[model samples]
Target chain A: MNMRCTKARRYLSQAMDEQLPPAVTRQLDEHLDACRECRDFREDLALGRRLLGATEPSLSGNFDWRLQLKLNQALQKAAGETAYPWLEEKPRGRGWAGNFTTAAAFGLAAVLALAMFIGPQGRVMPDDAGRYAGFETSRQVAGGVSDRLPLNRGALAPLSAPRGIQRSVSGSFGLGDFSPNAAFVLDSGWSGNHLKDLATIQELKLRNQRLNNQLYQYQQQISILRRQLDRPDSNGLDLGR
Target chain B: MNPSRDEHRHGSPSAARFDLVETRDEDLIVMVQDGNRKAFDELAARYKNRLFSFILRMVKEPVLAEELTQETLIRVYIHAGKYREIAKFSTWVFTIATNLVRNKMRQRSRRPQLLSLNPAPADDEIPLDPADPVADPSEEIQRRELALVINEATAAIPEKYRIPFLLREVEQLSYEEIQQVTGLKLGTVRSRINRARNRFRQLIKPLLKDETLLAELEMIEARVAEQKDNPS
Candidate 1:
């Protein structure tokens, strides 16, 4: 066989696959007809294809059943992870800490509101009769004394004085007296509405603190569940097996 | 005639209103990407036999082939969203199976002892042409023996050539499709398949001395020549 025979042999294989151009097929056919060696090679190639084609294998009967089980397990796991990506990683400790911080903030706000209520009450000054008398005499000496003063009686009233004295003094001064044990109070010269507004604000602060605590506990539970889901054994789907 | 058959044959008004639904593999795969489990099952059922045969021939072990086939299908199911329609679905699937075979071959090469056993039972099914009557039991036995010899000869071929050969002859993949699956250039795929055929011919030459086999070869050559002449 010459070099042309070798080339023709390659063309023969391509011809079987329907890959050869018409020109090459004609050249190969001409070579095969003239060369006995190339004809034998062509025969061998055809025989090999026939034998290989006949040997295609088939799977056993139970193949699909077994594969289906494994596939279902894998798909289910994939779906679960897709639905909750947090299950793939550890729930960050920062998330739970953030919730705790928010709760702490609410508590701080409540404390600040309580302080606003109690801080001014501790500094309450007793209504001294001598002080009032001195103040009246000074006013008279300085200038002609007015019939009334513009002081806030509710916040500055002397609790130590009798009710009658307190009433008489406040009435003469044209100021409204309020209870010393009032839950919320503003500075003197403010209206009664101001005190009511402060009390409403303190009530809202307490409610906000309660809601924040509830939210913090719920977040903590979610973090715990996320951590559990991240564990390999938690879902009872042993991936390694 | 049955009422549905009469309706179908006569092209009834209701039948004309609905188009026939013939889902292609790409459409089924798109459905899979959309999280349709039934579509996934359909895809798996469609490719299981072809994939198992290809992987089995590559690995030469039934159990490993079955495992690899399942792994390939599972990978497809999980990564359905990654598939692009630029390539044929078969090309993509065969590429995955081929990569897995390469990995298994590499692992086997590392541990020679592990490769010593091939416990899977040999495929004993005969490929008797249904059109031909079995006139003699001896002839059937001869065909089976010839098939076994051919299987051994194929297994003896170099892995580089054997893969392209199987992809072409067994799987009936086009040269371009084989190129995509193997990541080889067009010229390389052509040459590898040619060399594989040459090698297979040399290996099986001794077995072809039988008169019956030679006659079969002649018939095959004549048929091939006819096909060439007709160019169909």
Candidate 2:
């Protein structure tokens, strides 16, 4: 091959690395077979690679330890700080916390259950202080102290007053003690609603029950998997046969 | 690459052992996620050198390479909780490193002044031996000339092509992995690698006028051709 042609062939040979369709590879191979200069160019390419092999990268002496320390520190910092805890675990589904909140709401409603039963009877008595204190405490525990008390007046009656005396006693208080804000404080009219209070408690209890069941099932499945893995295989129950 | 898809018809125990040593990247990820610090250390140890060299070559600064390597590992650690086992760990790590390098490149680019590109070659340049120096200087001169030409050619390759080129040629990542790391299409990666190699070849062709090295290469080619002509 002429000098120009030899260089051109070398270019084509290099191009073959990128042009690997069967047709292109075939054409390049055929050209290489006929062209001595191109074949020689290919040899130089291979020799360059072989010589360059000696220069493979070696790890710096402290690379591993340095990187490992950096990684550990970063992870430690991340763990120490408050982040979305849900983000750390693989996103499976809403977790125990979700169900726990629901269950807690139900527990609050159950304690408040008596308030609805007694709130509306008009039997003017003074023994409702315990139920009021309990309901308020439970609400404060289950839900954070906020500007609003989430009062459903219709739902409050049955739980607020189980009997007429209790109803009258609670009526004197008239949801005033529950409200930090006065204008929004519920009235005596709200004390007379019994059926709505029962309905709300029942609704909350149902939801809480469902969540509790789901939480239980998840726990059970996890335990079953753990137990199965924990059991020894006994090496196929070896016997001197 | 698709070892799982292959039928286990030929390979024996030794081949299986080789495969084990190759390390399924997903296993490493699972280990790291499980809070296995030693496994994480192993993962870092496996790729740190190659990744450091890549960063060093691109940034041309040892201290910067060290920082980037540390940053890459930190990213991996922080993201361990978020790691999806769907991809190879090496691909994920390289993707992180690639982003860091690209960000550094962008930051460097934003500077108005054209900062000097490569590190001073003198630090690595070897002095000729005084005890038995070459008498007829042409051959010794040719080697130095070739080395200098090769360095210039490699350094001159544009950033777009240089990464794929270096990863494929120097780091020996497969074209698929190069594409994953670079976030480029497979065809583009191959094209860039080819372009880089061809550029290097073109650069080296002038210095290769040395008759002796040229003859040796030709002899190697003839031997290869002869072996092909007569298959065992």
Candidate 3:
């Protein structure tokens, strides 16, 4: 295609989204009117967009109910976690009982997990707990090491003004607004030791690089001297090294 | 797609700040930050389907999509206070959704997954819209086949292009919004979308060119139009 056709086609997608400025849009319309190829390109892209958008699989009708259940569970779990931080710790401690306890904690937490809400008295919603009294007893399905590791508590300390911090399911690294616990976060090793370890690692990395550079300089000097000594025209001065 | 409807039909008694339905998402989120849990419910109601649909297209599994949508919404709820007015609420929400989708996709990639030709859909799936053009039986059958082809084309688009492309074509987000969502430059977003569109166009070119299908589709639309006009 010629430059004009290329430029017009470049703007075709933006035009489809109605994203182009009015002036650019007018110019694009002019191009499309004059050019059959650009016109066809726009039509084809529009058809594609229409076809893809047609297959929208809608959310279930009872979506809100399901979400409410999940939210209640989250609130209850948050409360349970605050009461027992060790339960929230990583599963580095191995063995049958360790695994079972953690798993049971999760399963029980899942089943007995109160679907709680804040009532007018600022009390946990006891009614939901009764409604979903028989909660799912599914085992804590941890996705290997990453799932087991606790979130970096220190990274979460600054934003403690709201509620306590809760990690999103898959967003394990992300720290968000939640229950209030700034005091605990400040004293935790997650920030201090983690920072110290990182600094140590970085320093080591830099020192290693410096040593390698010094060694390279020594090796270069040795190589130059050896070359001079090997040459028949070399003066005995090369041997003084 | 303007296809999503808020699932919360009954409004809650709380959310005393303003009319949750009438308020902008940004304002609603501010109320959420201000300790109104109902405001978050309103936000979740507004976003659940849209997020589910967007994630489903990426992950290609309904259950996983539902889980991710819930997780993303929960993050939005729990983290409402942390969210600043620096970005659009939709942009921020999609960013969280995108993260979950990427994480799930990464985890799924580790193990080989077998694709079932006909997977059972979740129980609560909303019924198909009656106004859908492919409502007739003959059109329905043809459309199913077409849908399979289109789905494959969608899955085939590379990950980087896929999100931006879907956000554009499916979510109908503006280029600027998409740039914010994907953390891509404006020009980069446009070019990637262009590449994706070009690739999809190429893959589905034969289907579009199938004159018989086109003619049949045209006939179906004509018949539907006639029915609408006559109402008998």
Candidate 1 chain B minimal-lDDT segment of 10 residues: B125-134
Query: Comparing 1 and 3 by TM-score, which wins?
Result: 3
Instruction: Kindly list the per-residue Cα lDDT of model 3 for residues B1-232, writing each as its tens digit.
Output: 1111121211222321235687788877765664457668889988887898788878876667787898999888878888898988999999999988998888878966666755666555432334444357776667556666777888888999999999988888889999999889999999999889988888778778777766755654565467669764
* Candidate 2 iRMSD, 1 decimal: 10.4
A1-241 in candidate 1: lDDT tens per residue? 2338668877888888888888777777777779998888877787677776655555666677677788889966765555445457655677878889889999998777666534553444444442223222222211231222223443334333444332222111111253243332222221224575466456545544544555556765764554443332354233476
Backbone-clash count (model 2): 19
Off by over 4 Å in 1: A1-3, A80-241, B1-21, B115-147, B212-232
What is model 3's DockQ versus the real complex? 0.11
Residue by residue across B15-74, what tens digits does model 2's lDDT show?
A: 344332355666655545544455466677677777876776577555677779779877
What is candidate 2's CAPRI-style docking category based on DockQ?
Answer: incorrect
Go through the candidates in order and give the C-alpha RMSD of each one to the true structure: 19.9, 14.6, 28.5
State, as a TM-score between 0 and 1, how close model 3 is to the true structure.
Answer: 0.56
DockQ of 2: 0.13
Candidate by candidate, in order, the iRMS in Å equals: 14.6, 10.4, 27.3
Worst 10 residues of 2 chain A by lDDT: A165-174
How far in Å is the alpha carbon of A190 misplaced in model 2?
27
Superposed Cα deviation of residue B152, candidate 3 (Å): 2.1
- Cα lDDT tens digits, model 3, A1-241, are 3239888888887777777899888888788778997888887888787677655566655667777788889976765565444458675758898888889899876544232111111321223323211111111223311222222343223233223322222212212243154421211111224575466446545544554555556765764564444333444343555
